[model samples]
Target: MKKPPIWFWQIALLVMIFIIWHIATSPDLIPPIFFDNEYRAAFFFGEPAKIFNAIWVWFMSGEIYPHLWVTLQETLLAFAIGTLLGLAVGLWLGLTPLASAILDPYIKAMNAMPRVILAPIFMVWFGLGIWSKVALGVTLVFFIVFFNVYQGVKEVSPVVLNNARMLGANASQLLRYVYLPSATSWVFSSLHTSVGMAFVGAVVGEYLGSAKGVGYLIHQAEGAFDINTVFAGILVLTVFALLLDFVVTFAENKLLKWRPQQAETETT
Candidate 1:
């Protein structure tokens, strides 16, 4: 037979994984070799069929939308605010050697600190609302963007800088034409990772304490020993995270159209 397309293989792999998971967790299908009871596997790992059913029930009941919306809102706000702040600060420090030197240790210290530890502190400061989650996410996202932007600005070609200066390019003109483009390119490169971090921060904050969010749903499920529902919540979050990453990739393609295509480079 002719070889299948890449997507077909990819989907086949995913289906195979689910099939194995289903078999491993189904009490009737798998014997209780590891556990004393036949149902122990299903009780602990959960049945894939039941997990899918739980997810279907959640969506059909329209009970998951509010939680999803809350998580999305927190992630977006954190991403936006963190990116802006990081870009601004990175530009300022990247362009100023003296300030950069002075603040280097402090910046490193802050980045080194465990950001998850700040979630509780943020909860205390911002209360148990979306703002707290947003704050935690900002901490996670800010450093990633900041470091990328900083490196991008610092890595600007010295030849290009000299040429711009020779052409009498003013500070504002250099920043607009050179610095911003370079920094934004790096920002886009890190966008996917930053988005994932944002999601993690939001969910973790919700898991710790919140009235609404997919994380809150997972937490509640855990409390009730509802492994199926917990897995359902994780599945929903994973799907949405992939969707968000797709959106980021779309935006990157649109914004970076000026960059040479990989196929064209390869052909050359």
Candidate 2:
């Protein structure tokens, strides 16, 4: 017999998970070993069918668009601003030994700090509007790209730098040709992670305080004990996050075609 395609297994796994989730959550579908009441299972875990239904209702009623748009705006703005700041600071510090040494301890301390606590401070400074959420997301995204770019610059071979210097390459020429290209790969490598962090920051900010966004929706659902709607909101965020990650991969492929391709494992 022929082997099934990889995608077949992927789809099958998702279907199986949904089936199990449905069974485990539907009242009377299974014994209430964990919960005192069979209804409590469905109440706490929520039924898969109802979760999907809640999503469908939100779309059909056209209620989720504005919220989604708000989240997308926050995420994109945060990603852009953070990436720019990271690129600039990383390039500067990575190139300047004195500056890097001066700020090394402070940079490490800031990166070590938990960013969630800063959300409240941002809310106070920027208010409950979109800027607060964007500010929170920038903090989340900045470090990842900063580290990657800094490392990339440091990774530039001394031999290559010497050759360029001997060839009379000026500072601007060396930066434009040597440093930027070396850092490009690292920047792209960090894109997926940084984008996800931006999404996380936006959602978290919205969860804490906001009148809009999917996180806001989930918060509202939680207050009302509407487990299905909460799950639906979560699902929406997850799906969009995945789509954004896919875009990053697609852009990487297009932009990095000049780079060597990795070998794929053959199924024998």
Candidate 3:
């Protein structure tokens, strides 16, 4: 018999998980071993079918698009601003030892501080708007990209630097041709993580204080004790996050094509 492809197994695994979840959560589907009451499972974990139906109804009614758009806007804005700032600061410090040394402790301290706590302050400062969400997200994203870019720049071989200098490469030329390309890889790597952080920041901000966005919807559901709607909101956010990750993967493949393939290296 022919072996199934990887995707087939992947989908099969997903189906199996759903089956188990459905069996566990659906009333009368299986005997209630833990809970004496049949409706207990649905009350706590929620029925998958009800969650799916809620999501379907949300989309069919065109009720989710505006909230989804707001979340995406906040996420994208935060990611862009944070990445640019991180890249600039990383490059400046990585290239200049004195500045790096001077700012190192402050940078470390800021990074060490639990940033989620700043959400309330940001909400106060930015007034429970998208900017507050974006601000929180920037804090989450900046350090990840900054450290990666710094390490990438520092990891450039001295031999390569010396050779470029010997070939009469000026500081500007070297930075443009060498350092930027080296850091580009690290930036892309950090971007995947940053995207998730951006979403988290946005959603958390909405959760803290907002009248709109999926987080607000989830919060509303929670307040009303609507477990299925809460699960539906989470499911929507998760699918969107995966879609954002897919976009990042596509961009990475296209941008990093100049890098050697792992399969080629292994074959060699």
Candidate 4:
């Protein structure tokens, strides 16, 4: 028979993971290796069966929808706002050396600062609302896109610039046709990380202070020492992030079609 497909191995790995998790946390199985009481292992790591049940119950009851919605709202809002701001600033500074020189220290300082601590300050200003989370996420996302776009603009080939200029291309035309197309790839490259950062910011803000969102659910579970519920929340968030990443990948494929495909080398 032909070798199993890649997805077969992928699913096999997932099944193997669950199998190992089940054995490790099962009261009837390997608990003796780690603990005297069978229940102790289940208590600490949590049984995979219980974790899945918690997730199932959550969806079946429709209780997770509102929280998931709130989280998604925060994430999308932050991602859009941050990307626009980063793109504008990155292009502005990349084009103007004098302005870039003046703001270099300040920009570096802000990027170097620990952004998490600003969450409390944002909560103070935005009053424990989604804005605070959005602000926190913007701080995280802004730098990644800003740096990437800035580099992309700076790295535009001088020969390319001379050709464009020699062709009598105006400044605006250069920006539209040359700079943007070059930076487009860099912006797309940073998007996945920026989106993940935005999600993290939303969750962390909710974890710190919020009435809803999956992070709040995890917080409540932690408070109750409900290990299975906590793990379920984590698994849900992981799935949610993967879904967002899939969206990014789909968009990347559509938008980056203009980019030439790199050929793979053959092996003997």
Candidate 5:
């Protein structure tokens, strides 16, 4: 028989996995490996029920919102600033061949380095404030977007460029109508991944040294051996990351209407 849509299979598989997870962790179900060490198993396998309970207590009790808000603020600020900078730099480099060729090695070298390890340096320079987190996030987001946009522009057909020039398109017009549209899809693809990187950067910065944020909350929970709370904070961060990705998808849909619908469907 012909297979069902990918979404159908994906949803079914996810549901099945969740059900299995729930069953495996239930107190009544004892795996052979956990029979001798139930307490350790509980810790390792995790109590889904208690995870939900902890989430309720932290959320319903209004204990987590303030910290969540702080984390969200930092995440969003970093995402916005980083995305804008990436767009500006990417567009400039992509449109200017000479500039791109000149800076290519330097850009690759920087991007190749272990950026996360530089979190401490950012903290030292920006002094553990929101700025440090923003700076770190910017570093993470910039290279991903830059490379994609540059490649996208480079991939544009020479024929298309010639046609636009023949139509009397000025440099600004060419950039707006040709180069940007050419790179828009690639930019969005990079952005979808970059959103998570931005969050990672912000959170890692918080983990290293911060007075607030979800990462800070997770750090505190770890120090106290509150694994449940650590997991809860992670869940919250994941939800926000998904939300940001959805926003990017929505924008991509709107902006790339000219692209083939089948391409979008296949990508999804």
Candidate 6:
């Protein structure tokens, strides 16, 4: 038996989505159901065309790039800082049992709390500028990578560690040759997820308080009752999120080439 190429399935899925969206949103395809003088069920269910039109307008007008760049900047900065901190902390804690024991309760308490609610506090401390958004994003991204790397290092084979130690491997050699290699997959796995979380944190921070970023644009559109534009802004954020995820995936593939490749999983 033979299977279709993976890209063929991807393209087919995209085409099917386009077809359904076009059919559902075409003005001539369905009649509007009036809910009230001001509300129409069709408007709610059939806004795909409107959303696409708004996106077209944005692209043609070239007004979206600046906002997109602002959001990207915040997301990237936060991702870098958060991932670095997570890697460092995860390694340190994984290597030092005493330090891990001392910080366990405090770390758990902080991670357990609703971090987003701290946005206002962050804004008060860091202002409504990009720093606040980056701070929020860093908070979101940090714990994800931290937990994964911590677990990854912990999961290193005891037999392997014993053999290395018996062979006279020092602390630095064990970390370099054993812990990092063991944790590489876990780090990349968390990184892919952290990318999205970082973006979400940044955008939500912008929503709460910001003069710029795509989230602010979306917030403005909603206040003006421009549903189409709001949807367009959402679409822009989703596209960029996918782009960032793709970047992480590429890095993971490059870094974890020693890992066994798995069959592609079905995506909903």
lDDT of 3: 0.93
Tens digits of lDDT, candidate 1, 1-268: 9988999999999999999989988888868878899889889998899999999989999999999999999999999999999999999999999999999999999999998998888999999999999999999999999999999999999899889988999999999888999899999999999999999999999999999999999999999999999999999999999999999999999999987776764433
The local lDDT score (0 to 100) that residue 266 gets in candidate 3 is 47
RMSD of each: 1.8, 2.0, 2.0, 2.4, 3.9, 4.1
lDDT of 6: 0.87
Give every collision pair in model 1. none
Model 2 scores worst on lDDT over the 10 consecutive residues at: 259-268
lDDT of 3 at 104: 93
lDDT of each: 0.94, 0.94, 0.93, 0.92, 0.81, 0.87
Error of 5 at 187 (Å): 1.0
Candidates 1 and 2, the one with greater TM-score: 1
Best by TM-score: 1
Q: Residues 225-252, candidate 5, lDDT per residue (tens digit)?
A: 7776777777788887888888878988
Number of backbone collisions per candidate, in order? 0, 0, 0, 0, 0, 0
> Residues 135-193, candidate 2, lDDT per residue (tens digit)?
99999899998999999999998999999999999999999999988888899999999
- Taking all chains together, the TM-score of candidate 4 against the true structure is 0.94
Candidate 4: tens digits of C-alpha lDDT, residues 151-225? 999999999999999999999999988998898789998989999999999999999988899999999999999
lDDT by residue (tens digit), candidate 3, 97-196: 9999999999999999999999999988998779999999999999999999999999988898889999999999999888988888899978799999
Off by over 4 Å in 6: 1-29, 37-39, 42-46, 263-268
Indicate whether candidate 1 or candidate 6 has the larger lDDT.
1
The residue ranges of model 3 lying beyond 4 angstroms of the native Cα positions read 265-268
The 10-residue segment of model 5 with minimum total lDDT is 259-268
Per-residue lDDT of candidate 6, residues 1-268 (tens digit): 8999999999999889867866655566665334542234435543677788888988899888888888999999989999889988999999899999999999999899999999999999999999999999999999998999899989999999999999999999999988987876787877878988889999999999899999999999888877778878988888888888888888888888887778667779
Error of 6 at 195 (Å): 0.8
